[model samples]
Target: MSIITLSPAILDAQADGRGIVALESTIITHGMPWPQNLEMARQVEATVREHGAEPATIAVLDGTLHVGLTDAQLEKLAQAKHVAKLSRADLAVCMAERRTGATTVAATMIAANLASIRIFATGGIGGVHRGAESSFDISADLHELAQTPVTVVAAGAKAILDLPKTLEVLETLGVPVIAYGQDQLPAFWSREAGLRAPLRMDTPEQIARAHRMRAALGLPGGQLIANPIPAEAEIPRDVLAPVIEQANADAARHGISGKALTPYLLQRIFELTQGRSLDANIALVLNNARLAAQIACRMTLLT
Candidate 1:
């Protein structure tokens, strides 16, 4: 049996020359619980299709790297217990062990590139964690973007990370941080990070052209398209700053570090914001998926 399995929809889309958008599975397996994850996954796939692309939600199920999940596979994975979170480091290890795994941004990009899928959408990319100078807890997503030739569309790096440090590291990695239709990059749940984006493109066509140009120039890595959340759906940075600070403080107080740090902070923020954070997350993810699909369509047109 082949290690990679494409759903009939993706295979059909490929044959028909339709655009395809790669989606990360961590958003389903690790981002939420129960039926909500299933609903969100369905809605994201539908959004991709509605915008003229097929959605390939990446995961490793029973050691097979599934590029596009069937509804039954999606439901099973959503409810699976002890699913490993696969990044650049452990993705192959999990597969070798024949365990189920959810793909993070890095792992998803690797899978998408292997499958020749050019675009990926997700809520936010992980980055340099806070106090990373001490903990050295930077995320592999940054380095993956430095080498993988797959365009990733995300609202931004999670606001809980050190945004400035993350930006600096991306710069060091020679990644183009392009904000879509805006001057400043987004801050995940918030619309503004107070940091000017390195580049800006206002339309899907321009973004697609840029992607093509990168290949023409033999660029090593992918573009980071920072698609900001719609204004009405965004939580302002001013409103979110204190909540993030409080969350970080709580994590530090509890001596939370490493992988446990992020989820802890996010949960605290969700509680402090009275569940508004998750709502905003859903909105931003949907928004990113829509933009990613548009870009994917333009990508095929350019091809």
Candidate 2:
């Protein structure tokens, strides 16, 4: 049985050798509430199209792994309750069980690779959780970046996580952490995370070249492009720090752990910031989507 399905738009793009940027479905399924999630999904896809790239939003539906979702499929997935968040470990199992699932960063990278899409855009990647040294709760997204060959563009690791520790783990894994247009890594909602980026690239062509160079050198894993949120959209690191700390404390108080921790922290931050966090998140996501499209287009030209 054929397990992979491509939307008509993506199929046409592939046939025409046009650029295609892969997007994760969890942003729709797990990142926001119903109507907003659906609206964001549509807007992000439109952004990709406007930038001359096709958007392939990956997900699993009724035992089929879809490389791109139709408008109806995206709407249904956004509104569906309790969708399984599939990561590296359970992506295949979810498909095998004929269950509908939203792909996280790791699973999305896996699917993007399977479909020959070399670039993925997301709001942020998960990383070393706070107290990971004791809790051993690092996100699989980090490991996926260490092995998957698709370039991932995000603001950075979620701010609720331990940013320095996340960068340390990425360094240990030998992944290239490139900050776009700046020397500092970006926090999810903030332009500056107060950590120095190991590499810096100012243009999409440069990033695309770096990605190809890695493949030429036979390197495992992909690059992490820390694209900063627009200045007006950023919440500023100092302002977000206390908010994150409070949210983390709340999570610990409520005994939230594992997959539940991220959503809980994000929701709390949204409330704590009076909806500013979600606004920043949407802005950053759209920014990353535009950059991912540019990179994908550059890669297509290189190929």
Candidate 3:
């Protein structure tokens, strides 16, 4: 396979030994609204910098895979309408078509591996959706985690999905799920998903060591660091339960399925929660970015 071209900004960071954290672009194009999406993208990068690491926001624009983006690029992407949400299946097709694309978790992981970036931070990863048994609607993220060699720090799987089933899929795929500071897994907007994590690592160094160990053992896939949302920022499972149920019901009633399902449910949840869900979502992402940077810094020492 041919190499994917990266922006000069990302090239410099990778060469300079600065702890580089990979960020997905879908959050800018599909995860949030215009100005706020642009703002959040910048804030997440700034947060990584403040924590002693450089941020590489990955996306595909006009046939080019950008490992890090400039402010102009970020703004352009945030406002651009109908940009393809690129993932493992269509990443190369979009690049071949010379079209603009926002990298989802799987696409971002592929780009991160190409750029030799070891750590990635994102809000939440997609997984086995509810009723996936018949629909067969599993997210590409689970398979990507099983093959990509980058450490992904997220607030667990998105709360809208079946958390236990997602965990089972990860376990079946041989991916490690390490819950940070807590034994229970996080449920996106909520701090606890009411399920025990497969592994626990309390510090960045420990996480970094695990990454190193995997590489030493010649493991092919990455580890998931389930960093919980802050207590103050969390929506609490009890409070989120009813909201999620309502959102799921709304999706079913409206016949929303596949890719449309997540965004639809999220928007409904935002409305249902009076926008509290969006607030909590932003808080959790920033929290994950900070921890990813710390782990990135530790990995840098090894390199």
Candidate 4:
């Protein structure tokens, strides 16, 4: 059997040379609960379509790597339990074991590149977790950005992480971290992370050109486009800081670490914020989808 299974729509888009934006499925399986996850997935894909690009939501199901999922697949994955959250280190292992798995930013990029998709959209990218000096627990997403050739549009690193350290590591890895239409890097749920971005680009066309130019210059890795959440949907940094601190404290109290930490923090924040954080997440994801679609379209034009 072929390692990859492309959805009919994705195959058609590829045949027609249409713009395609890759989406990660971990947002559906691991980021949220049932119905809301399904709804967000649909809305995000719709946003990509509305912006003149196809959405390829990548995942691995029963040993098959799917470049794009159909509606039925999306529904199944949304409600599926025991889904492995596959990243760079374990994506292939999950496939070999014939397990259903959702792709993280790192795994998604690898699959996206295999499908020749040039852009991806997500709520946020993982980075250096807090207390990493001793834990040394950095996300594979950062290393993937240093090697994969897909431009990723995200709200920025999840706010629960050490933002400054994340930025420092990206710099060391030679990854271009460009804030979109702003000078400040966006926190996952907030418009301002209180850190100046390393670079800034105000237009999708400019971002596309930079992506191509990197390839021309023989640069390895993709660019990180830090797109801010729509202001109307953002939880102001001042308002969210305390809530995040509380959640972090709760996690530390429970000794929650590693893979369990992110989800626990997000869920706690969602509860503490009265569901506002999830709303912000959905808004940011849709916002990123729109920007990624525009960038993908611009890339097609440049091609």
Candidate 5:
């Protein structure tokens, strides 16, 4: 009858009314190499703590929806091979099958909502993949944002996705895409995606208030805080354009599709960009974690 499971630490923190930020586990199991992924996960959690918030990295282990993970559990999950990358569609199936799976953006949002965690931080969100019109390869993260109430802070949609299409879909679904201190929407590694953002909000207090206002207005979905990568860390759009084009071309040439395309494109982009892309990704995620933690703290005071 248990609908959700909580790690002892998270349960204790929640009981005390501490601000807790929910993180996705797929970044560990599917996003990076073993030691680096584990280390990055630890660093992100620590970043939240340093900003006076508790970190609840969500996942499903052995059929249980874990609201948070222990250090040992994080290590095991980071190193475990062949673990499933779960989204809204297959999240239930993974639990029913009693298998281990890392929560993607959508699944993480679902787990966060169930646990009453309001904030989530990630590198970037998945979106309409190239050729989605024909392939229907839209990410469940889009729909999850349309209905889930967890506020997500990320750089932007992954640069490899169809950015214009992603924004269009978000608009059509009534999901607010607020660019933080910027006029243009950020592309994952780059500071600007060359497209005007739908909304602009400069402060965490403002962002938190917007979330409250959404509830007051009976808005069903969450908001997207498009926090840009640090200026110095960005790869610049022009420089990254050809790189992304090349990666996309290679993906098409190889006929990679579905879930495999993202990882493949990322790895190839890392190679083509000489690892600058990964460096930028880490920077933006940490930046978002700090901002999300601040917002969560403000939300606690406001609510």
Candidate 6:
């Protein structure tokens, strides 16, 4: 009756006290198309290994929470149809139903924390959606960071969200939003979001130390490492602003809301960008994976 299934590599990493970076599964199941998603998953895991850390891609497969999937398992998950996208609210229910599910940031943090894995890498964390006064729309990813002890590395909040409001909410929740090597926060595909991050750390050592200090102080929340997307791969904010606006408009026109809205907006943006947005997404994810691995390695050294 083991509820959690750790992959052989993950178990070995835990036993050897090696650095292990937890990766979320939503990117494979909800973020991209099939073959490309599979390819991206392989590349992200490879990048983590290349940077001297083991990658533990978290997902739920047949009622089992897997902390690092084998190649065949990854392939099957990638090709599987109609997998539930699990967040904190639905992860346990999906498991109880014996349904396969992909982990969102919240669920991934929960799983990583449960497995004692301290670092996670993702494309971007979700945040306050536009017009929150009326719709009260927000993402659970922010709140999860406020309580989960896993350090999350990302290109920052997805550009589709209200960046300023997201930052405000993170501050309210007492989460440390550290911009990696920069003053301005990154906006997913773009390098700058036109707002200042609350904190900045130039090296992985600094980030690792901060994470350690937080635990030493008995803090409840985790650290957010806002790693910017590579400059060469960025789509530029001015160019993407209108694309995001148009995508949001389209989604609203179609009466999309809640969980269904993100994919719909992303799809419209992808169509508007002529596939450039997806390429930037892939590049940023690889970049974040690299940074996350470096931080994880540093964490092990600190220990």
lDDT string, candidate 6, 36-141, tens digits = 9999999999999999999999999999999999999999999999999999999999999988999999999999999999999999999999988799999999
TM-score against truth, every candidate: 0.98, 0.99, 0.98, 0.99, 0.98, 0.99
Worst 10 residues of 2 by lDDT: 27-36
Residue runs of model 6 more than 4 Å from their true location after superposition: none
Root-mean-square deviation per candidate: 0.9, 0.7, 1.3, 0.7, 1.0, 0.6
C-alpha lDDT of all candidate models, in order: 0.93, 0.94, 0.92, 0.95, 0.93, 0.95
Per-residue accuracy of model 2 over 124-208 as CA lDDT, tens digit each: 9999998998999999999999999999999999988889999999999999999999999998899899999999999999999
Clashing pairs in 5: none
Candidate 4, residue 81: lDDT: 94
Per-residue lDDT, model 3, residue 261, is 90
Cα miss at 186, model 1 (Å)?
0.7
Model 5 error, position 234 (Å): 1.0
Would you list the clashing residue pairs of candidate 4? none
lDDT by residue for model 4 over 49-104, one digit each (tens)? 99999999999999899999999999999999999999999998998989899999
Task: Show how many residue pairs clash in every candidate, following the order shown.
Answer: 0, 0, 0, 0, 0, 0
How far out, in Å, is residue 125 in model 4? 0.2
TM-score of 1: 0.98
Which tens-of-lDDT digit does each residue in 96-140 have in candidate 1?
888899999999999999989999999999999988898899999
